[model samples]
Target: MGRILDQPYDVNLQVTAVLSKLSLLPHPHLHEYLLDPYISLAPGCRSLFSVIVRVVGDLMLRIHRIPEFTPKLLLVRKRLLGLEPEGINIDHVTLLEGVIVLEEFCKELAAIAFVKYHAAASSSP
Candidate 1:
């Protein structure tokens, strides 16, 4: 999301590109937007629901490299995988929660990354 690269934080094209890909995918599952973008919109069509959860889970695990980000990321991945507090009984509702977690992490990471970027820039020149 743009949150990761916005002001106060140095914009990293590579990071922004990754987050952008993630932002588009979670919308429909999270809401019934004007464009009607729900990935799991097809009722009883479990496949769409499955795919979104898997992809979002995978992306979250892969993108977070910072040491501070690891703990929460792992917990989210576990929940996505249905490893803790229960198993993966993913439905539209659960997927919504998952995306919310992902979005929250994105915001958190953006803030941390931005602060580091600002610090680095200030020292650069």
Candidate 2:
């Protein structure tokens, strides 16, 4: 004996088919991230984060870009800051959050770069 189909398909397959029919709404932030270098954490904070994220994203994109680094970074953040996930979709939220954190990391690196720049300038005398 076999179960009857709702519309000549398996229930799970039908659900997935229906879900797949739904379209992703276009996100301006994501589009801006792709197109504009100026659209970032802050004006001075832009270049450093942009370069780092672009490099990382480029490397990851070569392997299909699963966005796994976001969660891993969040895990590192949790360990360092004792933060915890707030909701069910924490993984998705971590993507944007991780970018912001990486931006801050880059900003610190930029500070180091600035110090190096000043040191070189002073030493050239």
Candidate 3:
């Protein structure tokens, strides 16, 4: 999963991702990471989270990000409701929260991987 982000994109990785659902840590892992504890998490958020995470990570560094997904999602909702982009107002703080979620996710995942690597290395002598 970490490798997917670090490496350049490829179809092979895409296929493998679909086939394995990223091996337990599927796309919903990121969604759940982004959402509040009141929200539900599942493996069904691949497409949305893929774009959201990319956009959030691309726009800001992890340390200073706010990962609120609602406002961005509201844009899509507006279009679906046959409304123009500017027809609706956005919650700036909520939007920032969504971006922050993505940044926190990267930090948390990296820390977990770092600890895992160390545990394995230490056990190996």
Candidate 4:
């Protein structure tokens, strides 16, 4: 997820937007550290901490109401849990772009999270 922001302009607008929103952490330094790979952090505890903080911050931001998804998600939830059991049917054709963007976003986040673990494990021995 962090790397997506550094990609060229040809990247998908929805993916960029999602990444932007996700990386909007409360502290400027922390947010900048995550988005900017050039910023140097010491290689042991601080480096690991920064990665953990960024991933956690991104996850926290994702739980809030995103304008593009909140209404639709609420409707879907209502339909599933409320009176309209049949309304769980979604129009995938219309939602294809959103679905793809979300898929990419999830994959990116997973990659970012796992990379830290992998790097740490590889360095240990």
Against the hidden reference, what TM-scores do the models get? 0.29, 0.32, 0.32, 0.29
RMSD of 1: 16.5
lDDT of candidate 4 over 1-125, digit per residue (tens): 33332333235455546554655444556554545445676655344235445655654565353454655555654553464565354533223333344445556655654665576579996
> Can you tell me which runs of candidate 3 are displaced by over 4 Å?
1-53, 57-90
Candidate structures ordered by lDDT, highest first: 4, 3, 1, 2
What is the per-residue lDDT of model 3 for residues 1-125, given as tens digits with 9 covering 90 to 100?
Answer: 32232333243235334533332343554435432234444566444345545665655553244344545555644553468555555544333433334444555545554654576579995
TM-score of 3: 0.32
Task: Please give, for residues 1-125, the per-residue lDDT of candidate 2 as tens digits.
Answer: 01111122234234333322221123455434433346656555444236556655644543244456556555645643557654434333334344444445445445544654576589896
lDDT, candidates in the order shown: 0.44, 0.43, 0.45, 0.48
Consecutive 10-residue window with the lowest summed lDDT within model 3: 1-10
Identify the candidate with maximal lDDT: 4
Model 4, CA-based lDDT: 0.48
Q: What is the lDDT of residue 20 in candidate 4?
A: 46
Q: Candidate 1, residues 7-122: lDDT per residue as tens digits?
A: 22223335444544543443543222211224434564443235445566665664453344445445555765678775434323333344444465556545644654576579
TM-score of candidate 1 to 2 decimals = 0.29
Which stretches in model 4 have alpha-carbon errors above 4 Å? 1-94
